[model samples]
Target: MSLPFILFFVFALISVGGAILLIMAREPIHSALALILVMMSLAGLYLMLGAEFIAAVQIIVYAGAIMVLFVFVIMLLNAGTEERTDWSKIAKYAGLPLGILLLLELAHWMAHSLIGRTPANGAGSANVMVSTRELSMQLFQKYLFPFEATSILILIAILGALVLAKRDE
Candidate 1:
């Protein structure tokens, strides 16, 4: 296989593996770290596709800022590994096959969707970067309400975590 093909496969594996690890990890911190890996792998994939601006945004916004928020919340909550619980035989037997089938279906769908949609004009070089002024104007004017609502939601999340972390009866 060609080198680029190999790199794509490797990054794809890292993305999938990190997602699976995030789900399977018992500790909140481990899950958060796994999520960071997933985000970084996605950013790498964006870089490989030559959308450097998008890659940088993913690294800065999702991987850096959002992940820091997640990690901070996890640490502030002092969350620990979940206690082990017994798995039902039906869940283990049926859920595994269903999950695998869903995974296969998703893979098939993605492959088919992407196969005919290669970047036009070049190796993703045709992606247009929006101007900083346009972005700021949209963020502050058009999307201001949504942005403020999101901030409120995050604040609520932090407050809820604080309340839940209290030891008071």
Candidate 2:
């Protein structure tokens, strides 16, 4: 296999392994650490795809900011101890159907994505065309409102987190 494909497979394995560890870990802090590993692996995958700007953004936004927030919240909650996760009797029936549905949805989406992708043009540049001029043009023209809206949403979420984390009166 080619180098890029090999790297992609390795990163995918790391990403999925991290996800599994995050889910199976009993300790919340360990889970958080595993999630950070998952995020870093995803950033590596983004780099392999030749989206250098997006890869950097993924590292900055998810690995740096979001993982810090996750670790902070895990510490704030003092969740080091393993919590009992045994489902109650009522949950058994509900959880079975939910799990089946989730699996079906995942399978369907995977099949759809494999079948419906548009082929990329041959002889095109492998790297993303992310010059400052192109970024500015797309940011202003195509994604202006959504970008502004997400900024507003992030501001509100930060404020909400602060309020929630404040000392109780």
lDDT of 2 by residue, 72-169 (tens): 88888887678777778766988778989999999999788865475542222466445656767898899999999999999999899899979998
In model 2, which residue pairs have backbone atoms overlapping below 3 Å? none
Cα RMSD for candidate 2?
3.7
Report the number of the highest-TM-score candidate.
Answer: 2
Model 1, 1-169: lDDT tens digits are 6665787888899999999999889998999999999999998888777667678899999998999999998898899989877888988999999999999999999788876686442333334544556767878999999999999999999999899978897
Cα lDDT listed for each candidate: 0.84, 0.81
23 Cα displacement, candidate 1 (Å)? 1.5
Worst 10 residues of 2 by lDDT: 120-129
lDDT of 2: 0.81
